[model samples]
Target: MKNKSVGIREVAQHAGVSTASISRALNSPESVSPALRLKVDAAIAALGYIPDAAARALSSRRTRTIGAIIPTVDNAMFARGIEALQRYLSLQGYLLLLATSGYDPEVEFRQAQNMVSRGVDGLILRGDTHTEGLRRLLATQRMPFVNVGVYHPDKPYASIGADNEDAAWRATRYLIGLGHTRIAMVAAMSAHNDRASARVAGVRRALKEQGLPLPDDWYYEVHYRLDDARQAARALMARPERPTAVVCGNDVLAYGVLLEVERHGLQVPGDISVMGFDDLEWSRHLRPSLTTMHLPTDEVWTRAGEHLVKQLSGQPCVMHHEVDATLVVRESTAPPRADA
Candidate 1:
């Protein structure tokens, strides 16, 4: 009732080429001339032949597949980066496998173990911090991996990303220059997130340098959910002396803060100024445009993908690459009011 699957020999016969030529064309197209590749491709299409990936991997000892684990795909920033990474990998004749850690180190380690067991050629991880077991497993296997989203050249592993601390410090400095002394922060939970922790540290450093008080109640760490950010902002605003400005760790938190401000009938940059990191697409289109930090998401992820590909291909790549995050000022921040 059904015909058998086409094999390489049939493809070679159809293309009037030897089986070895067909092999070279499929395995390493660059090794053969363009005309030979075209002939093999046409023959393969004519016969509907599908190469056996299992046999090929067994012979080559490489799967030609890469694995990536991110904290969460719910955020637009991570989504955009993952999309870019996948596109780059596909163009390089490799496949991308993805997993989410949900900001949990234990979960991340488990996912890493699973990916390794599946025989991925390399791994791309988010942040430099990882479970000891995960690191040990990778080291035991001598697996090639790179950390994205935060740059730390001093670390043992390869890293490609923005300098979180400096970016946040610059952001805080901008708010300070606007005459906003009473500033608060709605930051992501920093427990397992080195990026968020670094951003918080940067904000603290800037406030300290300027002799501005960073009161205990002024800093709030919540989940990256909009509702959580809204709740944190509501709590901050309920206090007798509300802050004149609020700095958020990322754009999602900033969006939540903006919504809460509107709900409370407060005007942005008038009663309260707000800003964020990761200048997301909708940030610029908001009623009062959001002033935020812009990360080169596509470039960062593409470079991370390139680094892993190079390591797998036996090419030398720099251990660290730092992409700067610049501030994007808009309608949301201004000098604080003289009265009150």
Candidate 2:
């Protein structure tokens, strides 16, 4: 005769623990003591028990699913964070549901509503510039959610990310230290992004500190696409008084800027110096290795996932988790040439 499916009760009995303990061990491992969890795991292995997801959902009202809505999944910067989030969530027996807004707040709100309707237990969002409708929906539902990519303690929502303003300030200051007064920035559009807005603020502040004026055309914002970056760089260079140094919003933008500058017969660090943000893998391998800011993408998203899980387990979570982004000096940046 075929053996009946092993159940939680059977596993608990074999493990000499209560059904409640078994449940905690399975869903909220952090809540259970190490010794107790080990015993439950051993019993589960010995009994060959497979948890009944449906029953757990019914009793706990948990979907064991997390949803994330980022600006754009097509970009590798956001893709790396999403990958890290998925790995951490899966380790906790939770599935990740992903959606992208193409940088549109309305689309992000619709996606958030759809995920909520689908009964996600938690959410991980890129930034907090979501539509008011989505904000109201989340507040009304009282669902656990964490914002990733920018950190602000004064905000109502919980967040786990790098301090965008400080990081950008440091990056800009590095360029100033290189003795480049004619500086320009190619940045991501700040229309609905707190991170981009904060970074722009940082750049402006850094320039002000050095008594350098940031003229209207000196700072350009565009989408997170290589082609847009190329155009922005070309336009900046076409100006009557071109900048000797350029700061890009991200590595991809930096890639585009570098290519455009080279296409114009300008030798990097000889006529112009460029700086990039986000020390991505390719940044290190570029012909003239990039001098950039190293944002901890994996660490931030992994921590965001753990924070969401803790909140879902009815545990108190830290509201603001900030990671550091440090400057990486490489070959692409140097003091402007004497003649230039």
TM-score: which candidate is best? 1
* Candidate whose lDDT is highest: 1
Model 2, span 241-270: residue lDDT tens? 989999888889999999999999988878
**After TM-score superposition, what is the CA distance of residue 211 in candidate 1 from its true location, in Å?**
0.7
Off by over 4 Å in 1: 1-4, 12-18, 28-47
Error in Å for residue 216 of model 2 = 3.2
Clash pairs, model 1 backbone: none
- In model 1, how large is the Cα lDDT of residue 46? 82
In model 2, what lDDT does residue 177 have? 90
lDDT of 1 by residue, 176-291 (tens): 99998999999999999999999999999999998998788888999989999999999988999999999999999999999999999999989999999999999999989999
Model 2 residue runs over 4 Å out of place are: 1-22, 32-50
Q: lDDT values of the candidates?
A: 0.91, 0.88
Candidate 2 accuracy as lDDT: 0.88
